[model samples]
Target: MLVWERPEPPDRPVPAPLSRERIVQAAIRLADADGLDAVSLRKVAAELDVGPMRLYGYLATKEELLDLMVDAVHAEIRPTGDGWREVLLSLAETTRRAAHRHEWLADLLGGRPQLGPNTLTGGEAVLAAMGDVDLDVVVPAVSAVAAYVIGAVRREITERRAERESGMDQRQWQVTHGPYLLRLFATGRFPALAAVVHDGPHLDADQTFRTGLDFLLDGIGARISP
Candidate 1:
């Protein structure tokens, strides 16, 4: 029989009561303030005033930490409504507001499959709202809603960021660029463009988003019972 001595664990002093939630929160703050690139194990540890290795105990890698952060925000989405349409609408609004508050969220929206407990809870809410729909159709219906939410929110966030950085709102952007586009129309090669640009009503971002949502929901409503 061979005998070997067991090695002792590291003898460093105890870390400040670390937890996965706490670690994720710290990372979120960094992301919120400085964007997602600013979040790193080293940076998170520095924010928490502990060694990086301490975070390793809670999250195995940066990807795991990011996943936790994404789910943490998903927990903020609270959908309340009487039926599937209302529920999906509420869900879309909640997700949009969350993304508005945390623009970095747009960076990861729909980038990966969300599998955390909080993310699962949000999905469960969508499923419950779906009521007695056929199981086969339920997932597809939910997925369509989710796709619309993510795609629309991502575009909204991106345009918002561009507006902020350019010091111009969407309306201002159209005003500044609309004339140039109109010039091309004047050349007589694009009568359709000229007609639309000349006659179309200028829509604010909210109107555009809401109208698009209604249109999408109208299509989805056709498939469901109610």
Candidate 2:
């Protein structure tokens, strides 16, 4: 059973009370600092200054803890705006921002069905914001935006990590590889590809994300009955 579905243990009188919230928070901190691989029941117990066995009252396994952590982060995604498009835009942007704040989130996003309280609430808000659309339209519309957000956020985080590890920004990385790319493109055989490399807009990450999202929304708008 999911951790959220199981009722939390009643508070016991102890020098330092240990609850699921504390356990999840400690796990999140470990994940935020050193990525998901760093998070474990043992580490979280240590962070809380409790024995590893003490955590069993609140969590059954590491996967449960991960689920809680992901849902906890979802609390940061607050959707706003009046119409379906505007609301979905808000949801997508906020979800992206949340992933940026918690880079480990990219690893867990869309990996499983998240039915935690906060995730359910966010879904409810998004569906509610869709107003009176038919269920088929609303479900697909929300799923499309969500899929885009997950894919975009994962790609953005991957690039960001690569840049950090390589100690070079995107432009610097491109410049470093310029000679090889120049040689590859110099061949007259690849005209179309060379043209884009030489003349592309060179948008920053945020601009690129927003632009792609807008294009997607426009396409969806065209399909929606007015």
* Per-model TM-score on C-alpha atoms: 0.88, 0.96
Best by the lDDT measure? 2
Q: Write the per-residue lDDT of candidate 2 for residues 59-146, one digit (tens) a residue.
A: 8999889999999999999888988898999999999999999999999998879989999999889999888878878888888999
What clash count goes with each model?
Answer: 0, 0
Candidate 2: which stretches are off by over 4 Å? 13-15
- CA-lDDT, candidates in order: 0.81, 0.89
After superposing candidate 1, which stretches have Cα over 4 Å from the reference? 1-15
- Which pairs in model 1 have colliding backbones? none
Candidate 1 lDDT score at position 121: 84
Task: Name every residue pair that clashes in candidate 2.
Answer: none
Best by TM-score: 2
Q: Give the Å shift of residue 148 in candidate 1.
A: 1.3
Q: After best superposition, candidate 1 residue 136: deviation in angstroms?
A: 3.7
